[model samples]
Target: MIKSTQQSDNERWDGEGGSQIAELAKSLAIEELEEADRRILAFLGASVLCLWDELPDDARQKVLNRELVQSSFDASVVRARIALLFK
Candidate 1:
């Protein structure tokens, strides 16, 4: 019973994370892509997703956490540049 519960929890987490990733990818496609680029980007995104899924859970978590930090830093840098331009 406990094992079944753990499996369900993992499935729920995976489903939620997958949906979030898909939504973000779709939003990026809408915002920045031309129609011609969409197919190529979608193919690349699928390939990356497959690779991501093959990673061990711990490795995937580490990579994602590091990416979050890097993304935060990048956003801050961009914001600072924009502020400088305005000033």
Candidate 2:
């Protein structure tokens, strides 16, 4: 499906928020990912807000483990992990 272009939140909303977190998630310096990846990451972040506690312990650990991997990571892998994270 096509993504929305309109403002999604008050004050700030452009999917760059996820890029900022992805930037901060690293121990060493890293460049921002493409906007699509950032948008996916932002959705992941948002999903975690609502779904984290609802997941079983094993599933949660599996996801957290995936997220703890290297910064030069694949967005698809991260997306899969996020999907599994909340499943």
Candidate 3:
């Protein structure tokens, strides 16, 4: 018998990753983190439908500034929708 050389993503994450994330989330300051640890912070903050519920409360508060981003994103949609509708 031989050990498999490859492992699935689930098996990889079944180790200490969850605890590491929890520990990181507890200490993370999203504003500072986003600039410093961009991808990991982003991965922590992102969610389906833009909810970002996975982030810790402190990190979430600092990271989830959707009003401005949402407004800006919505503005583009609104602009495109009305671009030819009215003019």
Candidate 4:
């Protein structure tokens, strides 16, 4: 049925996206980190995640409002940067 086909397509797309994210994470990981550096990176990553998780509802709403105001200009600049890189 059409529904089953759509579900399978979605699952395939999700799998591909997940693999791409995993590959990016692998590429971003520090290749030659010392134990101390690795511990520092882990601590920083955990702290960032915790800080994000602890953001207040009003702060999040403000961020969303600011993003909405800036997104179009930001996106246009990003597109221009990408275009320059390709040129």
Candidate 5:
């Protein structure tokens, strides 16, 4: 099942004895996770980045659409426009 696979992946990621490439793959797997699930995985990933000399491919691509980025951008633009009006 999908849930079991995901759990197993996390377990594998947390396990020891992988090469740098293996660890990178694990981090990439975590990057695609849901936000609630991502919280701890993000910490684990940051630890890997800090401890390991090598990093995985940049985790920029979203597994799904993320509206938050556009929403925040819109808010920031509105705030800037408002600030200009007050200035």
Candidate 6:
């Protein structure tokens, strides 16, 4: 369900779309990741951010209680912290 939706969102974002994370990452001159890798990462980031954007305001304050958010992070506090940008 959401997986397919996210894949489509990723594709759309890779095309004619603008996002904060992509803008911030675009300024980096580092060669660690190629442009392709950067795009792939950006698409994945869009999926997560879009997911978080759909949540209710109250749930946004305490995402740990939301199974969708928790499962999306897979119990990784570090990974989940990235979504805190919305909070």
Candidate 3, residues 1-87: lDDT per residue as tens digits? Answer: 134434454457557254545554454343443243455435434642176455467765444344443344343353454445546
Prediction RMSDs, each to the true structure: 10.4, 10.2, 15.1, 13.6, 15.3, 12.9
Which model scores highest in TM-score? Answer: 2
Tell me the TM-score of model 3: 0.21
Candidate 1, residues 1-87: lDDT per residue as tens digits? Answer: 999999999889777675565444444324344554455545655776789878789877764453463445443454454457557
| Candidate 2 off by > 4 Å | 1-24, 27-32, 66-68, 75-87
lDDT of each: 0.57, 0.56, 0.45, 0.56, 0.49, 0.54
**Model 3, runs deviating above 4 Å:** 1-16, 30-87
Candidate 6 residue-wise lDDT, 1-87, digit = tens: 999999889888767334533553444432455565456546765675689878787765553333344344322343344346447
Output the number of the lDDT-best candidate.
1
By summed lDDT, which 10 consecutive residues of candidate 1 come out lowest? 24-33
Total clashing pairs in model 5: 0
* True-structure RMSD for candidate 5: 15.3
Where in model 4 is the C-alpha error above 4 Å? 1-21, 53-87
Model 3 / residue 22 / CA error / Å: 0.3
Q: What is the C-alpha RMSD, rounded to one decimal, of candidate 6?
A: 12.9
Model 3, C-alpha of 45: deviation from truth (Å) = 3.9
Off by over 4 Å in 1: 1-16, 26-32, 53-87
Ranking by TM-score: 2, 1, 4, 6, 5, 3
Ordering by lDDT: 1, 2, 4, 6, 5, 3
What's the CA error at residue 54 for candidate 6, in Å?
5.7
